[model samples]
Target: MLHLLTPDEIFPSLPEVDLERLQRRGVRGLVLDLDNTLVAYGGREAAEPVLVWLREARAAGMRLCILSNGRPRRVRLTAERLGLPWVESYTKPRRRGFRAAARLLGTRPHETAVLGDQIFTDVLGGHRAGFVTVLVNPVSRRELPHTRVVRAIERLVFALLLRRGRIDREAWRLRTS
Candidate 1:
């Protein structure tokens, strides 16, 4: 169960992810979390750096899809602004949405990567759906009240994982090899 919530890799931010490395590892598509991952919660647009990184990933022949639990209108508009397709209003920590996003990208589970800031949602769902998962630190501390509560639990789980050497706090890449 803990492994289901464990991210395959960790990066400080979306822009820090190595697109080339992911491509070499056969990651053909990216299932991205919009809020807190690409942009701050409630922000209208992703920062310029994130936009540039996304463009670079697309240029590298990697497909991208926004998979978010946010409202449909907000998710749709954000996707449009980023000029990407999106899967919105679907609950996370569920395999259905992750599979849908993978299908949307025309990639099999092994060929897709899910990137988000939350472990319980993105990491767990991606793992359940059999896709590689990458976790990034949240862009901002500002978040929904319920999310704040979840964050507390997330911290506890992370601590346990860290202590057990299942996760490395100092290492940006969590690969065992």
Candidate 2:
């Protein structure tokens, strides 16, 4: 399941990915989910650590762009503030948003990676779009009640994978990190 990343997943919290690794994976572009993945949903600006990561990723020569399901005003303001290329009203778990973002990035599906905090939206959409998918744990535990319910479902999905012996924590971290 896309919910689980490789064992190498690390923290603060980068999977320790950089340009060399991305190139090795044949990835030249990135599609990022805004909330929880890059910043907390309620945040107006990305955290300093996230900004540093973004800079590091860019310096490594990766073409990064943001794709979010948020409304036009929200997404646009965030993108403008961050100086990032972005699309608003992204309907994740569907191919349209991914496809549009890919086109805007001038990236082929084969050379793009889509990363987000939610498996149902981010991972599924990226996987369906034929890009490499990455699912990161959400940064915030405090969320709306609706979001909390989805988080529960997400955990259940991961737990099922663990019980099936498809994932072991250490192995998962190593692959992702």
Candidate 3:
């Protein structure tokens, strides 16, 4: 059960994700989370770096879409800013959201990758949907109260993984590069 929640890859941030490597691995589409995955929660738009990365990924023939649990208005605003399609109030960790995202990208689940900051939601949902799952550190510490509780549990899981040597110390560190 816990294993299902584990991410296939872990990065400190979106920029640290090796898009080229993903492309090489035959990932043709991306299902990205909005808050904390692409930007800090409540951010109105993606940062310049993120926008550039998305453009490059698209140029490389990767389809992209934002799938988030946020309200439609918020999701639409962010998607419009990044010029990407989106599905809002996605109710993640549910296979429906993942399936919807894959459909939007015009790809099969196995050929798509899902990136986000949560394990129970993004990772679990992606894994359940048979998509490659990447977990990134949250961009900001500020999160909803419920998410804070989940973060505590995530920290415990990380500690256990560290102790068992399932992951390296670097996995817990925020990577700037």
Q: TM-score winner among the candidates?
A: 1
Query: What is each predicted model's overall lDDT from 0 to 1?
Result: 0.89, 0.72, 0.85
List candidate 3 segments past 4 Å from native: 174-177
**What tens-digit string does per-residue lDDT give for candidate 1 at 1-177?**
889988888888899999988888799999999999998999878999999999899899999999999989999998999999999746897888988898899999999999999988999999999999999889889999999999989888887888888887674233221
Between candidates 1 and 3, name the one with more favorable TM-score.
Answer: 1
Question: Which candidate order results from sorting by TM-score in descending order?
Answer: 1, 3, 2
User: lDDT: which is higher, 1 or 2?
Assistant: 1
Q: Between prediction 2 and prediction 3, which has the larger TM-score?
A: 3
lDDT of 2 by residue, 132-160 (tens): 87656666666668878987786777666
Rank by lDDT, highest first: 1, 3, 2
TM-score, every prediction: 0.94, 0.85, 0.92
Error of 2 at 89 (Å): 2.9
TM-score of 1: 0.94
Better of 1 and 3 by lDDT: 1
